[model samples]
Target: MVVIHDGYFTDVEGCIKENWFQIDSLLAKQILCRFSLPFNKLAIFTLYNNCVHLSAICILINLFHIYILTRKALRTTSPIYILLTAIAMIDIVSLSYDIHTEIVEVYKVFKVCYSKETDYTIILLNNIMEFIRNYSRRCSTWLSFSIALIRTLIVKYPLNPKLEILSKPKIAFYIIPTILILSAPIHFMDIYKYQIVFYDENFKCTQFPSYTTLYYGSILSDYYEQDDVWLWKLNRTIDAVISKFIPCILFPIVTYLLVIEIRLADERRKKLNQSSIAEKDSKNTTKLVLFLTLPFFLGELPIGLILLTKPIDKLREAIGFSLFTEGIEKFFSVVLSATTATHMIVCVFMSSQYRESALSFIRCGVKFKSQNS
Candidate 1:
């Protein structure tokens, strides 16, 4: 019995020495760990693999849709056509990055092997992906806002020649480039905000310290106490407000005004007993804008809110609770990806122009195949 007690005591001492008693730390440490074989591994692999495949498929379909739309735009010289094409192009690029990131992650899990050189590549890709993801997201939201704002102007000032000029394809050429240029630099700041660190024999990219120094004559202070930390947090808050929340708020307001304008136009047309071609075209464009923006608002709002409210300390604290939180965060990421793919699918189904373009492309392919046969 004495020997048994001695052995048990030694085991407990060893566990304490190894820090296994720190359950919170253990859970936190496991947050980003690759899932082990059979169940967990299979589940994550399936989830990522499916997302990659679906996103790729949607991207290809959208590319075809863009080609058709561009050809139509050349003929019509319509600003709405130009904007739709630009949106499709952005979606394709964003989806490509999504697929690439998923592929790299899945490879990391299955192989469990990476070198220092590979670490640099991983870090670079991660930074690029982060920049593109944020840039594309903001661009999409802004483009939607532009559409709503322009439509509102058209409805409210139907006789304003200046507003009419702004709706031309020539103006879209300038507006699209301006939006791209504006949305890019803010997101590019992410390149400096993160760094790659070695963990579990693999390099992982994570946020760098917001401030390298605290102050003179002080024991190294906690990160949260740093002025730079709050500044960075505030920057993120402002970004979320501008890129996500404002657009969300404005979308509904502008859309409401659009509905009223449409009703007013319909009433005016009834009294005149003649609907001008421009009025019909404006109504159709409004329908397209509604279809495009509504899904984006619904699908992206949860993600934006999550980003705004996520606890900054969760990643730093090696705690068991963090595992649950991290898991929830990852689940949200999957939902976001699913929603992104759904947006393309929704476009194909809801937008008559996109659907017709896709169908026409398919028919052309069938005809070419028959001719070859």
Candidate 2:
């Protein structure tokens, strides 16, 4: 969502990331009335200032993550690496989209692009970025879940030939596409929910006197028919169930199983007084997946809770007046951007192969710099 001139358009629409909510309808009217200059600054800082730096850092980190995973040692270690490589790529795209929208908002906020007429293409372009951001963010969420599930299965059944398909790195070639295909349907609803409209007659911007007319994109209730409203609500519900709540639930369960299995494996190693490289690799993989899922699980839990209340009629009524959803939703953008940022650190600490390669990568950079100097 882009914020320009005294307008707040769009919100954290889904559980994993944002979809689209507009400023001209539903909660927007109340927000516009209650939140003025100070609040707008707060909203601005909350969404833009926080996300820009964090998102940029994460985008760079995710690039490194994708590159580091390409090392033959790390790549051959587990299929989780392949899935992780896919997740890192998505994270980079998602975080870059986050920064792009924030930059647009910053430009629109301080700069006067005065227009007596509506600019449909501007917000439409923002809508396209929102579409890609939400889609890639969802892909990251599902792939993280896939990693948890796959790693659990591989760790638990270390000798099952039935699970052999999952152990192959090439399976990610299949899994990534499957996730992209399956996670796509909900994002198609973006174009229908919001559109750019000219608010010339009723435009009110007391804070900014540079322009008399305001052309902003918002989710207008008037744009929806009765059936369309129901469809929109249904889509949100389905998205919450699939995107938000399910992973929040599954991550913990799979994490618990991984911990139990790894603990048991460690005890077995101690008893045997012997540890094979394969066994060591298995434990390390468990640790990597364990650390990997933590951020997603913690990040998604509160979002899932907010989504749980969205369907309740009483809470829905209160949401119009309450800034609870607004603050949390904007904060979610930063959180989503920072999700993959932690993975690199986790890898350096937990996964031996990644640690070695990461050191090697750093050394190569230093050596190159020395030669250039």
Candidate 3:
């Protein structure tokens, strides 16, 4: 999603105006025509399937939560369960947005002829895409960390009533708004490529931002130039510290804390081990954490390694190696998707409690339909 600026920013800076919208259907058709370009359809197909799988998994998670809410016996004051439900809901909404982009609109509009004015609809769509992309990145990072934190709390302080503060519903409600506020700065980031521009009857959006090529094409040059070097370094350093360093540090620490808590409980409670229910619960809980956390760690490693090697630019222009990079990205996305899907499968397959509850809900719906018939 990075851009390389070849000073097109200067040529178009004077053309940008606030409160303007443009949609060129002719341009959209032209863009989609490139689908005929010699590219790997297999890779594209894999990406499409990955997107569908992710969307379906998320939708199922949402359905599971609705089922949970239907079960009075299973309903409790347990904060952990509430947190899981909220996380599922968030994942569902985010995944739906992603699927909409891929299947519903690849940002293409076809018009038999060009309209003189910019399309307001496309402008609105562009803004919405920018907002969702920026905010979702921030939200997903924080939510995953929050989940890790909740698990650590449950394992570490099982009997501590004060641990109620980490309750799922409370944290879920609070964190959603907190993520929104934290991402407020994103509205001002303006660090996007392919922005709408107009100049002297030539109306089009350029991949590089007008008047600021430094933030566009070629990751290295985007943040590094002999001119304006300090601003670039400052921005790069901030991005590195927050995006790269914080998540890297936090995920591991929280994961380690969860592991230690589980071990401590296991060692301190030999009497409890005799109870089959306790042991089964403990094993399932451990599996849940391990299955979810492992992919995230694996996915994190490659990006971190690439950063350390200063390979962003090379990877971007890696024509010969581009396929390799794309493979790794697709693989990681699949790993994450598989892990998420496993969580849903666990709800139905491993947990008899959840399975029974889910089935009863389905049966009730069947009965209602039969009665109406």
Q: Against the true structure, whose lDDT is highest?
A: 2
- Write candidate 2's Cα lDDT for 298-345 as tens digits: 567666666666655554444332344555555665565667788888
Model 3 stretches with alpha carbons more than 4 Å out: 1-77, 102-120, 167-171, 183-194, 199-245, 271-283, 298-340, 349-352, 365-373
Q: What is the per-residue lDDT of model 3 for residues 147-264, given as tens digits with 9 covering 90 to 100?
A: 6777788778777888766644556567667765775673344354234433224444445324321211222233344454444445434544554457778888888888887777
Residue pairs that clash (backbone atoms under 3 angstroms), model 3: 3-216, 3-217, 4-217, 22-118, 22-119, 23-119, 79-168, 83-168
Give the worst 10-residue stretch by lDDT in candidate 2: 13-22
Give the winner by TM-score: 2
> Candidate 3 versus the native: TM-score?
0.62
Q: In model 2, which residue pairs have backbone atoms overlapping below 3 Å?
A: 22-219
What lDDT is obtained when candidate 3 is compared to the true structure? 0.50
Write the number of the candidate with greater lDDT, choosing between 1 and 2. 2
* Residue-by-residue lDDT tens digits, candidate 1, 191-256: 555545433333343344222111111121234336746745655666777787778788889999
Query: Per-prediction TM-score, please?
Result: 0.70, 0.78, 0.62
Rate residue 38 of model 3 by lDDT.
Answer: 20
